[model samples]
Target: MKSLNSDAFRMSIAWSRIFPHGRKEKGVSQAGVQFYHDLIDELLRNGIIPFVTVFHWDTPQALEDEYGGFLSERIVKDFREYAEFVFEEYGGKVKNWVTLNEPWVFAHAGYDVGKKAPGRCSSYVDKECPDGRSGYEAYLVSHNLLNAHAEAYEALKKCEKCIGSKVGIAHSPAWFEPHDFKDAADGASVDRALDFMMGWHLETTMKGDYPAIMKEIVGPRLPQFTQKQKEKLKNSADFVGINYYSSVFSNHVEKPDPSKPMFKQDSLITWEGKNVDDISIGSQPVTAALPVYARGFRKLLKHIKDKYNNPEIMIMENGYGEHFGNKDSVAVGTADHNRKYYLQRHLLAMHEAICIDKVNVTGYFVWSLLDNFEWQNGYKHRFGLYYIDFNDNLKRHEKESGKYYKEFLSQGVRPSAIKRDEL
Candidate 1:
């Protein structure tokens, strides 16, 4: 932690611990507050600035019961209240705040694909709502989530003592590569992937509205934003937090026309030869895991820089995970060499952003201080620079990557230091 320490460090409020019920009025655990109190004191003691994320996907199931979680329009006021509570409690010490972490995952993968918690499993195969909820419903939930984020931003504006503190939303924008470079249609498919992935939240933050395409696609099912609400969304974030991973390739696939809107107007397939309209697209071979594409990192930075008018960029999450599956292990094992390599390439790419692009790049946090519960994938994909033995009650052991990180930061990025084992 000391090696990478810059002028700023970001932290988050695990929503589940705070509002174990996911409702503002339901319950606020004193234990949870104390946990943060201890955490904040530690960070301050270390001279590390704490930037807090209010919700990081651990929403209390209670909120889901009350009004379908973010699906309900009521979530706006509720989330705003939660933000205010945190601000009042810790704003004197903790200033930088992020309203939510990765709304795209919350909406698309969590609710739509049903991969993570609060699962939704809908396939285009039957379209009978296998889970009894429409794609439109997930989108609606996301619509509510965006509004809730905006409200939280507005609430922080009133806190006078926390003047330097600011609130913003953290967005995970996935990038795509074109499956067939020769085909114009295929290239357009790649851009559309960015549209659905990052565009949803960026629209709310910068444009003061939801995606225009979502309105026509989701149609009446899409939620309405009041004019006053629109006005408030303007400049909702002082900065945009980005969590990016690997990039995928998009291919064209034709599909039948639907009453509700979807990604494909003409039905294009992703590179794997699956239909674009299939709800199983992500599961398709075309949607396979990305090998750390560093150039994609550069392109994504340029896109956000030129398109988003170069908002201050702080990488909220960017790291690799390896699955050798051996616990009680130590430094630079053969299994995690890829993760070490992934870190070097991505950091060089980040250097490109700061040096070449001049894109106002601020900070780079490598995913986590330690490996923790990675949702459904569980402990299978170890993203941490430090390895955690889950059987040991999540005991953290610094990997070669971790030591390399400390030295790399202490000395500076060096080619000889790029691969830690060799160093």
Candidate 2:
């Protein structure tokens, strides 16, 4: 971060590392506690602020073994303890805290799709999944995660040392555009899609309950927060952290069969990478993320501003992921023209949201500093500004994009100020 002229850095601590058995009763690791303090001290010494994410989907194995993680309400109490422990420990040094990073991703990918840790999904969704209630578990997990986040926020607010700290959950929401701009059904689907993805949590946090559309669609499958829980959730965050990557087209589904249940199907919206004419919505081909769609980003920001009474926001994670496969040439990696283009475009879009749209965006952080292990994708997809040589003792080399970021950070250059062709 110091080398890149960055002002703040974001990181997460492994839950099991702090409480080896995932509970304070098991015993706390003084060494594990000290490690983060040392790291925070180092970041502060280098003139960089720290944004600590309390939970980044690394639920302790023991917790999962004792009881299904997040699926059971029991996990909520443990999560609160874990969250409070960290807030109390580092409250004096770390002023910015994220209760959880992408609770939606954790719930859906982990419980619905069975692609992530503690993976579980209905046999119909992923035949290999050992066991899960696809539609039911995801909602249960999300409900617990939200409560955990709310409790954590309350804990931080009460802590004298952390009184002034800004705490929020980092939500990952993709911008969903209508497949056909003139199609009313498609346009409504776009709103439905947002309600399913972003509003599932955002609305709960902002309005003290879930979106009305979600309640009508998901119905009994959706979990309800108690009146007390609702009070805790409303205005839980001092600010909102959005981790946006790509945009997808939402087309209305004429009829969705409720007999065969799945969390995704409840939306009654099909998220398509390409529009009705099968055209890419961005500058590049559709891949893990829809190609760079800067305008979609602006739209998303504006929507948040208008719909959620825009508190404050930070672009927590935004970057492009390229699957280089087995290709391992430093010369090939360092060039990274596409990655640089991705950064420039997204940053420019965010700038427009901040300056022209008058959205209260406080900061932007690129997806990563180094190409590391991505969940399920593993290291196949590289999203980092810096390239890592996995086979060669994990040596790090700055890509062209990294150099460009350093210049942009140091010179206070808006991404729009530089011509794309100049790079």
Estimate TM-scores for all models: 0.86, 0.96
- Note the residue pairs that clash in candidate 2: none
Cα TM-score of candidate 1? 0.86
lDDT of each: 0.69, 0.85
Estimate candidate 2's alpha-carbon lDDT, on a 0 to 1 scale.
Answer: 0.85
Candidate 1: where are CA atoms >4 Å away? 1-9, 22-27, 123-132, 256-290, 325-335, 414-423
**For candidate 1, what is the total of clashing residue pairs?**
8
- State the local distance difference test value for candidate 1: 0.69
Angstrom error of the Cα, residue 258, model 2: value is: 1.3
Residue-level lDDT tens digits of model 1 in 1-423: 321347456677877787777765677899998999999999889877787888887666777777677767877777887878888888889877888889878776666656666766456523433462535656777777788887787778887767888677788976666666677877777756666678778867788776666665556766677898888887889887888777666776556356433433312444442233432222212111345666678788888888788888878788775555443254533245566666677777777677788887776777766776678877566677777776667666777677767777767765433443321
Model 2: lowest-lDDT 10 consecutive positions? 282-291
Candidate 2 lDDT by residue in tens digits, 280-309:
777664333347787888899999998888
Model 2, residue 128: C-alpha shift (Å): 1.2
